[model samples]
Target: MSFAPFSDAPGTLDAAATAARLPWSALAEEIAALLWDSTVSVPARSVLPLAQGGSLFVMPATDRSVAMTKLITFTPGNAGTGRPSIQGDVVVFDIATGERRLVLDGPTVTARRTAAVSLLAARHLAPVPQGPLLIVGAGVQGRAHAEAFVVGLGVQEVWIASRSAASAEALAAHVHALGAQARVVADADAALPHCPLVATCTPAQAVVLSATPRSDAFIAAVGAFTPTMVELAPALCQHVALHGTIVVDTGDAGHEAGDLLQAGLDVATMPMLRNVVCGPWTHGTRAGKGPVLFKSCGWAGWDLAAARLAMRRAAAEPPMPAAAVRVPA
Candidate 1:
């Protein structure tokens, strides 16, 4: 049988390459646009247990132009092991041609896109968008959140707190390198009153942030994604539910938002990102309301948005030599 050469193969991107294409400002904008786009469809993600308490996740989303699937493994115990806790790849395909288009580094997409979601929430929820910030749990998400706030919100100062002093210091150094003042706080609760903006990005097996924030503070709780994990205390969640406004990233949060679910809150009735951004909902900041809590449970649509943005940025770059690409028969 004669073999015909396929001209195009999927382009691959490593961690740095993927991150380069997803700038904080641009990624946030893309996600915001997707929030209002009814054409995008995201199915429920499937999770299966792996050895040693790890989990394998399969998430898929599609739009008219492209389709994406993210396959990743999450190992919470990878901490201090020099191995990433979350590892995977996001595969993008052209819907019209049914051909692979891009393979993006999964960890980079998760960190950047997840942080961008928080940034979008802050834009609408934060009382004082520009200023000092507090990040609990100085890990990959913590670092991403710090950078996103610095670039997207023009935040000048950051306070980092973690159980591991070394990790907190390392994240602080990273934030310092980003031209923002960074401090490794000994106690997150003590630092809470000083910073109006807070992002909790821990593992969420236990409560990391329990203190009551300022009346106008904005808190993005993104650490825990499943029903079994939780980051905020039940009391804190209840307090926010009663006195403040709680916004969920998507409708899926009703089942996956561990903080709100564990707190015994009805997540289904909460305002979603679309409602806050596109609808006439002004309970959080306007009219001098209480604190705003943004609960993020993650949605595959966010990954598709990142893939779309990455593809657009890649189109602007110089193409690689055709010979460098390996096309299978």
Candidate 2:
């Protein structure tokens, strides 16, 4: 039997649409299952650094029925050039036939799916009714987190903090424009007490969020993917040792990320998302904690999952000719 390769156009999904299509809890559960399943394969990503000061990553993943390759680019100056900071394309392939199936734009997908993952961690581990969230860094992650917390987690108030006061104010205004209660804080440290939920989104080489959070607080650090970037302080790692559940995205990435490396933290001993979902909750571990800390290394599995979700949604709509193609021999 000859298989026809269907060329699905790269669909552009806005943040709101993406959120509506892929809920945080559902995506997180899907990711958790994929990670736990022994049949699925997610290899270490391949990175290509741009000479102009950005990087691209190619991530490939596959199971029996589904396979996907996602190309993600991080261009910091793209925002100044009237483009998004992070953008890319995801190509989904038929695992059995090895035929191209679908293509999806990844900018909005990354933002929405990343926020969903963070929200899921908060929902399962963070303290309930945790309000007055503090978001450090006024970048894409900051804005996305605000929306997810408000729409998905029912957060009442959000405080925006950045090294640049103007950026923080602007982010606050943007979130408030969406009808959420949001404001800018002059001092990130001062806002810690009021924030039961804190998200660090900056790409800093040193710890930006150094203030100790309350025992009942929940923290999500989305920055610090590289060995040089650090968002949470050594003290925060100590706090995790003493009182909170320290959940890293993966053991290998955590070993390289500066936040863990600087603090001499070992993810080999830390509880991973896989452990939380599959294992028994024992005392003095991720299973027991009032304040929980989740550090995301931005895995490829997330991009693959988000791409699959987006493709499924795009497939459900009235078929567009742009999404179809004639196969050639």
Best by TM-score: 1
Off by over 4 Å in 2: 1-25, 77-83, 282-290, 320-329
lDDT of 2 by residue, 1-329 (tens): 86443334234433445555566656666666666667777898888999787889898877766788778898766643557778776677777767665655566667766787787677767775457889998878888888788777878789988887777888888878767788888788889988889888875645777777888888888877877778888887677767777777677665556787777877677776666666664333544455788888877777767756655665686654432422322
Candidate 1 residue spans exceeding 4 A from truth:
1-8, 282-285, 320-329
| Weakest ten-residue segment in model 2 by summed lDDT | 320-329
At residue 303, give the lDDT of candidate 1.
98
What tens digits encode model 1's per-residue C-alpha lDDT throughout 1-329? 64324445665767877888899999999998997788999988999999999999999999889899999999999976889999999999889977788888899999999999999989887888885999999889999999999999999999999999999999998988999999999989899899999999998889988899888889999999999999999989999889888999999898899999999999999999888888777544354678889999888999999999987887897764555333445
Using lDDT as the measure, the top candidate is: 1
Q: Provide the global lDDT of candidate 1 against the true structure.
A: 0.89
- Candidate 2 TM-score, true structure as reference: 0.84
Give RMSD to native, each candidate: 2.9, 3.9
Q: Candidate 1, TM-score vs. the true structure?
A: 0.93
